[model samples]
Every structure is written in structure tokens, then in C-alpha cells.
Target: MAPKQDKKVEEEEDAIYEVEEIVDHRRSKTKHNMVEYLIKWKDYAPEFNTWEKEHNVYSKGLINIYWAKQPYTLTQFKKKTHEGESSIPKKRPASSQATKIDRKQLAQEIKSSQISTSPPTGLVWTDIDAIVNVFHSEPNTYFAEVKWPGGKRNTYIPTRIIKKYNPLKLIYYYESQLEFYLPP
Candidate 1:
């Protein structure tokens, strides 16, 4: 009887809990730039859900899934934190910051924009003024928001395509966002 009691205690000490789901995620309050996730245990009730830091959670898939559902991208979130600005700016930035391109020309081009019927020759790298934003749209697929020469509004172009034409722009954009993309 003593041996059986000791065995049970050992089993209890080594037990591992399965994760039911990742409920949510948030930046850690006590740690700088730390991410935490709300976890639901496989066999536990709602009240038993707990918050775990990014490193404590073993499954990277859960973190990716949680982020996929969010409207904005991780790079956008990081930009907001570092710049102390909203993810989407409400007003146009100061002329010193945004006046490199001609706004009136960009507005006219956008208003008169038409889809070409000719066979696609692919993107002309020179026409792209800047790579401004990035996001994950589908499994293994990523997109970059590009600022056209006239610069009234940005458009989405697949990052893979940009890599073929001008990889430097993508590299620079990623550096500015302070994000590193690694597959799990």
C-alpha cells in the first residue's frame, strides 16, 4: 500500500495538461515588448483559463492562429508601439514627412485609374515609390502594401512578386517594421 501511494504521487507530479485552445493574446503589462496569451486547458472550465507568456506556450501555431484573426498585422502593431501613433493615421502627416510625391498628380491618377486589358507584363519596379505595410493573407502567402509614385493611396501586391523585381524594398520595409518572419 505504501508503494502504490508513492507511485500515485509521482504520477501526479509528472502530469501534463493539454491545451484546449488559445483564447486571446495581449502585450504583457510588467514586461517590455512581451506578448502573453490566454490559454484554455483541454479538460478545464472557463474559469480555469490562464494567461501564459509567449515563451511559456510551446505551440507556435496557436499564436499564429490568434494573430491571423486580428484585422491588423504584427508589423503594424509593432510600428504603433515604437512610433507612439495609431495603427491607422486619422490625418495626413506633415508636409515635411509626406510631401516627397505630388499629391495632386496621385489623386488624378487614382481617379482616372483603369484596368489594362493587355496581357500582364508584371510590375514595373520604377513606378513603386515605397513598400509601406505588410500582412499575412493566406497559408504561406504574404502581401505588401505599396505606395505608387503619385502617393494618394496604397495598394496590395504579393511580397513574392516584389522579391523578384526589387528585394531591397521588402528588406527595408521589414527592417523599418522591426519584424522578422520565421516559419514554425
Candidate 2:
């Protein structure tokens, strides 16, 4: 009888009982229920553009979130105090921009980053524009610089070498070994 009651409560709660496997964009130690996080953004963040926390988060934050390509557990994530955050500049990625940046010798650097980072994920893929940007951009660039797309350039990167972050490649996150798929 007690078990039956627990089930009812769980169902009524609309419990998000699963999580998807995804990579941590920040390289930080947080990869719990990435699925729920993205899903929430897709469902409620914005109709077409980025999704920012209307009250807790700021603008351009949503752009950064999508670029991460990670997942989080809805139930577990919501339980937290929800105060952690980072700065959100007033900009979007190169994809959302009109101006284009082209650098020389970017292919080699991206090839290196890919060669070094690829095997772990099994594969990686990217569009021609990103491929061009990676080749044109400098090497070992961080997500923040790239997240803004055309807003802020990664000048720290050597123009002599460039690399791209191909989304097609299958990156293997340590969390992927687990079995959890968020609601469609």
C-alpha cells in the first residue's frame, strides 16, 4: 500500500526520472542531467532565439547554453539553490552574425585539435562556415571566445594556425556510459 502511494506521488509530481549524456562546455565538474536543461530551453527558453533566465539569468546566456551541447537532470538540477552563474555578454555566435571572419592556415590547427580531441568522442562534425572559421581562427581557443561568434574574436590565437570545433564528431563524455534519456 505504501509503495502504491509513493508511485502516485511520483507520477503526480511529473518526475523527470532520466538524464541525457553530454559534454561540459566549461570543463567544470557539472554534467548531471544535461538533457533536462537543454529540453527546458527548447521547450520554454525562447521561441526561436536564445533562452535566458528571465529573472535569475541575463541576456545572451541562452546562446552559451546551446553551444555547450550537454544535458542535466531536471529533478536534481531544480533542487539546487540556483544561484551559480557566469557573465553573459551582449552578443551571439558567428552563426547569428552578418559579418564573416576568415583567417589563413586555420585548417591545420583545427585538424590538430580534432586529431587530439576526436578519438575520444569517436567522431566530430561541423558546417562549412564553422569549418572555415575554425581554419581561419587561431588554435586552442576557448568556448567563450567562440560562443560569441562574430562579437569578440579570438585574437589570442595565432593567426599562423587555426582550428574548428566540428559538431559532427561524436564526442564521448564520461557521463554517456550511463543510461538516461530525457523526455522527447
Candidate 3:
């Protein structure tokens, strides 16, 4: 019985030591905080790593030792701190920064402008009348808001199938729409 009790004590000590050495330190970004460190268990894969508060890990003295041993530069630290987000400052929506009257005035200006009715040379108007607005574009695709002669509006038309049409104007128009409508 005495021998068994001694062996059990030894096993508990070994378990404590295992926990001490198993901490693998890494950093991450959280919504509330700009920077955080993820504590990964030595024997576990990266997917199982958990985000731990700096205060909690610092109290244990594990992170201090880890940071001292790692030879990372300032740029690397910034990169780690801002992981999962763009480095560039996001632009706010134009409407949020402008007055309601200004927005109404701008809308009126856009509505009053006369876009050319005739299709560019070699392009046929076909079933549509004129391009009134544009919504989005990608590498090989473009979406436009078109108007018909009867004052009907088609909000989404793919520009790729339109023959002899250059999509630059539509792409520029879409970007402008994003500037006005999208919240950063």
C-alpha cells in the first residue's frame, strides 16, 4: 500500500511537468482586441490550437520566455497583430459622410445626365435601349443596370455577351456605385 501511494505521487508530478512543457505559443487577431496569442499544445496539431488572453499566459510566464527566444522583427509583429484583416484603412460609405440633401442632389444629377443612346460602333442595341447604371465587375464578367426606351429598367445584365461593347465605362460606373453605396 505504501509503494502504491508513492508511485501515484510520482505520476502526478510527471503530469504537472508535462503540462508546463507542452505550451506552444502563437499569435492571432481577435475582433475585440487587435492582437492575441494562440496557445498550441505540443503534441497536438495546429487546428486544435486555442486563443488565450495575454494576461492569462503572462501570469504563467510561458509567453515571456517564448517571445524572448523568438527572433521576430517589428514588421512580423505587425503582420501577426493584423492577421485576417487588410492593412489598408477601409473607406466608409459616401452616404454616411454626406447629408441627406447632398445625397438627393447627387441622385438627381445622375438621373438627369443623358447617357448616349446610340450603341458604340459595331455594337447593336438589340433588345435593350441604353446603359443607365452599372453594378459590379470581375476579371471576365461585368454586370450593368440598363434602361429600355419605354423607361423600363433591367438591374442586372452581363456585358460579356454584348457584341462590340467595351466594358471599361461599365466597370468604372460600378466602382463609382460601390463608392456611394457600399459600407466599408
> Residue-pair clashes per candidate, as listed?
0, 24, 0
lDDT of 1 by residue, 75-122 (tens): 666455434656564534435435333333433343355222121245
Mind sharing the TM-score for model 1?
A: 0.39
**Tens-digit lDDT track for model 3 on 18-62?**
123324444444443333566665556767766665554432224
Residue 58's C-alpha lDDT in candidate 1? 59
State residue 173's C-alpha deviation in candidate 3, in Å.
63
lDDT per model vs. reference: 0.64, 0.31, 0.46
Q: Global CA lDDT of candidate 3, please?
A: 0.46
Best by lDDT: 1
Encode model 2's per-residue lDDT on 37-124: one tens digit a residue. 2223323323333322323222223433343222332232354422243334333333522222212223344444543322122222
Could you tell me the TM-score of candidate 2? 0.19
Which residue pairs of candidate 1 clash?
none
Work out how many backbone clashes candidate 1 has.
0
Question: Once all C-alphas are superposed, what RMSD does model 1 give against the true structure?
Answer: 14.8
Model 3 segments beyond 4 Å from truth? 1-28, 31-34, 42-47, 58-60, 73-184
Of 1 and 2, the candidate ahead on TM-score is 1
Candidate 2's C-alpha runs over 4 A off are: 1-38, 41-65, 68-88, 93-110, 114-184
